[model samples]
Target: MRYAICFTPTPSDPLSQVAANWLGRNVFSGEMVEPPAIRGIGIHEIAFHTAVPRRYGFHGVLKAPFHLAPDVSETQLLRDMMRFSGSFQPFRIPRIEVARLHNYFSLVPSVPCEYMHYLASAVVQHFDRFRAPLSEAEIERSDPDGLSAAQFANLHRWGNPYVMDEFRFHMPVTGPVNLVDMPRIEQALRNVFEPVLAEPVTVANIALMIEEGTGGPFRVHSLHPMGKVSARKIA
Candidate 1:
């Protein structure tokens, strides 16, 4: 199994519900969710665009997936996650909006927040001891030649190409979109997400997600609220 540390909105948060609907799966429950109707877009088209991200569910990556180091145990990792999450206090992002990152759509902060970067970097560095070195196949899959110098270096050292200085907090909402369909997709996104984005988003909880098999769906393992001493595992 591979483990990832990510930021998932609380189960009750409106954005969580929006994402669950958009992505066709609920990370919290591992249950299928029906996609919302998008004007000018058929249900099959929506499903096609969401296929890639649906497997990972709804989350903003703090640490990309990694196998446990030879000596590490899941219990130990969970304990450390509780301690790490508890050490920091929660903060809020002023606003977030749907934006295109390459060919995909993701929700990103309207302005950068240093606190989120700091937290992401901390997660990468702190739990790195628990990450096993990437396998040869893994390195090939990352397309090292396509990465910039910094990204390549990070890929080798951190096992994730986008870490530390390269981190950008984004909750992916769709896979690739055709250039011709971009405007319509953007409209649909705005229609579904505008209300939830009207207010500041609190960065209050971090979750541990697990993939039980290679190329399998990721499921929420537990949630750790920032500045709190406890963790709640989902059944």
Candidate 2:
């Protein structure tokens, strides 16, 4: 099984419910949700386009999936994650919007936030020791030759190319849409996600998501909230 560190909303959060409905799977609960019907979009079309992302569920990828190192255990990883989470305080992104990132649609921050980058970088660094080095199959799957020099270096170093400087926090809502279908899909996403985006998006907790095996749907393993104060010795 592979593990990923992500930013999933609590199961009860409206954002979680809405996104689960859109993607047709709740990563937190492992239940399927009915996708909303759109005027011009067929249910099959919605399902088709969402097929890839539906497996990943709804969350910003904090640390892309990786196998645990031979020396580490899931219990050890969990304990460290809890300790790491306590070091940072929760923060918010002022707003988010539906945008086509490269060829797919996702919700991205309306404006850049430095703190978001800092948090992502910290996550990548903090748990990297638990990550097993990428295997040859994994490297080929990532298309290392297609990556820029910096990305290639990051892949070998961090086991994920999109880390540190390359990280851009985005909550994917769809897999890929055809050019002719872009307008309809964009509108559909905006209609569903805009209301939730009207308020600030909170970054209160970090989640551990587990994929049982290749091509399996990822499920939430645990959530570690930020901002627990560590006791200090009085002088």
TM-score per candidate:
0.95, 0.95
CA displacement after TM-score superposition, residue 87 of candidate 2 (Å): 0.7
Q: What does the lDDT read for residue 196 in candidate 2?
A: 87
What is the lDDT of every predicted structure here? Answer: 0.91, 0.87
| Global Cα RMSD, each model | 3.0, 3.6
Clashing pairs in 2: none
Question: Lowest-scoring 10 consecutive residues by lDDT in candidate 1?
Answer: 226-235
RMSD of 1: 3.0
- Per-residue lDDT of candidate 1, residues 54-137 (tens digit): 999999999999999999999999999988888888888999999999999999999988999999999999999999999999
Off by over 4 Å in 2: 229-235
Looking at model 1, residue 104 earns an lDDT score of 90
lDDT, candidate 1, at 35: 90
**What TM-score should be assigned to candidate 2?**
0.95
